[model samples]
Target: MGRGIVKVWYDPEGDFLEVLFEKKEGYFRETSDDRVMEKVDMQGHVIGFSVLGTRNLAKMPLEVALS
Candidate 1:
């Protein structure tokens, strides 16, 4: 599979997360299928993460993908 780079911005008050990534040069969705949305499972008790995207380096807050 082709790999894409992603940057995520989290907002506590907004209760939502925004992601900016380099889509496979010209594909709609570079990482997963061709959609811009996905699901995640939270695994901790924290407010935010200080890591990069949701890869091995992703420090998942509560193990959940910020929605």
Candidate 2:
């Protein structure tokens, strides 16, 4: 694994949260969890992820495997 600057954004009105591991061109894709989406680069390497209903997460922890 490598480490670099990580970017995170939260939309309170939309109850959404997005995180980026790298500032690269990528698209969001469905994960096992419907509320979770993974962003992958052109080579299909995971570069980020998004979560829906983030406010609801206060009741529990959010956990998802990113490939």
TM-score on alpha carbons, each prediction = 0.27, 0.87
Candidate 1 has which clashing residue pairs, if any?
41-63, 42-62, 42-63, 42-64, 43-62, 43-63, 44-62
Clash totals in order:
7, 0
lDDT of each: 0.36, 0.89
Residue 59 lDDT (model 2): 89
In candidate 2, position 34 carries an lDDT of: 88
lDDT of 2 by residue, 1-67 (tens): 2477899999999999998998889899999888899999999999999999987787866777887
Best by lDDT: 2
- For every candidate in turn, the CA RMSD to the true structure comes to 13.1, 2.7
**Any idea what lDDT model 1 has?**
0.36
TM-score computed on alpha carbons, candidate 2: 0.87
lDDT of 2: 0.89
Local accuracy of candidate 1 as per-residue lDDT tens digits, 1-67: 2245556776565445544443222211122322234332243222222322324233433233433
